[model samples]
Target: MKQYDKKMIVKKSNELIDAGFELSLNESRLILYCVAQILPKQPIKPDEMYFVDAKNFSELFHLDIAGVYKTLKNAMHKLGDRWATVIDKNGDPKEIRWIISRQYFENQGVLGIQFHPEMLPYVSALKKHFTQYDIKFISRMKSSYGIPIYELLTKRRDLKEQTFTIDVLKRKLKLEGRYSAWRDFKRYVIEPAMNDLNNEFGEFDATYKTVKEGRAIVAVTFHYKPRNKSIPLFDKQGNPSSEAPQKRWEEYGYRSAFEFREALELSETHEFDLTDAKEFLKARGKPANK
Candidate 1:
C-alpha cells in the first residue's frame, strides 16, 4: 500500500551494481519499488509468497525460462550475504533455506509479498519494463492477493566467501610455461583485441593488477570501466555485463601466478581418464605414423 521512492530504488540498484551484479535500468527501477514496501521488522516466509515461481514471474514480463533464471541468478549473487528461505513442494521449510541479511532487506524493501532479496531486483526490473496493462495486473496482484507462490523454489545456503585463485595459462593452455606467459598473452593478444573491439564498438578503459601467493601467481585482476557512457560496447543485451567472456578473459590476465599454480594442482587432483583414443590419435595425426 505504501508508495515507493525513485531515489531509494536508484540508490539500491547502484549499490548492487557496484558489488558486481549488473542489472538493467528497468530492473533497477522495479527492485526499488518492491524494497520500499517490505516491512523491516518481519521476515516474510518464503513459501507464503506468490511471485517466486519462474513461470508466474516470467508471465509478468513475458520472459522465457532462461531469462527468468538469469535475472534471479544475478539478483541472488548481489544479495551476497543476505537471508532467505527455502521451501519444499508442500510449502514447508526444506531444512535448507536462504538466510538474507538485515542490511539487504533494509536497503531493498519487499514489494507485492515477502521474497528473497535477490528476487526483488529482477521482479522490480520486470515491472519497470513491461506494458502498462502488465504493470497494472502485477500492481493489482501486489495490492490484493500478493505473490504467495514460493514453494516451487529451493533457496540454497550462501557459501562462505572463499578467495578464488585463477590460473590462466595452465587452465587454458596446460603449458608449463613461465608466469610471464599470462602477462604476455594479455598484453599482446587480449589487451590489443579488447582495445580494438572497444574502439570499434566504443572504448572502455582496461586495467590489470597481479596477485601472488609466496612465489606463485595466485590470480590476476582485470578491471574495466567504460571510458564514457556514449560508447555502449556491451556485447550482450539485457544480461549483466560482468558475465561477458571478454571481461572474464581480461580479469584472468590480472590474476596472480599462485592462482594459476593452485588451479593446476586442483586439476591434477580431479584428473579424469581419457577413454576415447580416436580423437587423441587424430590430434597426433600423420606425424605419429611416420
Candidate 2:
C-alpha cells in the first residue's frame, strides 16, 4: 500500500465530518484511509461494499459489520433522507443492495462507480479491517437531480414570505383539512429542503428586524462567487480543451426581504379598496392572502 499524506487525510476527514458523519480522530483517519482507497476508481457499489445477504459489511477495520451498519445508519439519519438508502434491484426489497443515498453521492461528485485514482490506497487500507466481509462500491444507474430546499425557498421567497397565516398557507398550498400543516411544512418542506441545499452549497444568513409595532420582518443573505478568466480554447500543445473562461471573479451578495405576517395584514387593512367594499370586507375577517 502507498503511504498517505497527513494533510490529505485530514482534509478528507474534515469533508466526511462536514457531510454529517461523526467519528473519533482515529476512526476518522481510518475512514479517510478507506475512502482514499475506494474513491480512486469511483464510489463503490453496494455489492462491492457488502455481502449479497447485506448482513455483513466488508472488513475495513476491526469493527464488526453490525457496528459499521449502525455507524452508517446514524450518519445517514443525521444527513436526512438525502444521504440514506439501500439499493434494491428493480425496486424489489428482497434483492437488497446497500447503497448510499443518491443526493449525498452526487454532492460528493461521484458521478459513477469510478473514483479518482488518488483515493484508492485509502480504500485498500479500509478493507483490511473487513477481510471476512465482501463489499464493493458500484456506480449508480440513475441520475440525481433533486433541488435543495434552501434554493427553492430562495427562488420563491415571495410565496414563502407571504403573510399567509396558518390557514392561508394551508389553503393556498391545497393542504386544508390536514392537521399540523404548518408544523409539517416547517419540518418536512422548509427545514429539510433548505438544509439539504445549505449542505450541498453553503448556508444563507438569516436575520429579522422590527418593521412596525407587533410586526417583524425576515431577511436572508447569500454570497455567490463570479467567474473571472477567459475561456481556454486549447491546451499548450494546441489540442482542444473543454475549459471555459473564468469570468471576472468576485463575491456577489444577494438579500431577500419579507414582510412580517402582522405587517402584511395591517397593510392590507389600511389600503382596502373602496371599489369593492363587499369583497374587501369579506377578506378582512378571512385569513391574510399569501
Q: Estimate each model's TM-score.
A: 0.22, 0.22
Q: State the lDDT of candidate 2 residue by residue for 1-290, as single tens digits.
A: 22211211111221111122122322222233334333221344433431111121223222344444445434334322222121233753221111233122323322112222333322332211111001111111011111221222333333434122444333323345664634554554344433433332232332212222244222222232212222122222222234422322121111211222222223222443323334444445665333
C-alpha positional error of residue 18 in candidate 2 after TM-score superposition, expressed in Å: 23
| Model 2 regions more than 4 Å off | 1-47, 50-70, 73-180, 187-189, 192-290
Q: Flag regions of model 1 displaced more than 4 Å.
A: 1-209, 227-290
The 10 consecutive residues of candidate 2 with the worst lDDT sum are 132-141
> How much lDDT does candidate 2 score?
0.28
The lDDT for every candidate, in the order shown, is 0.31, 0.28
lDDT of 1 at 14: 23
Listed per candidate, the RMSD to the true structure in angstroms reads 24.0, 21.3
Q: Going through the candidates in order, what is the number of backbone clashes in each?
A: 40, 40
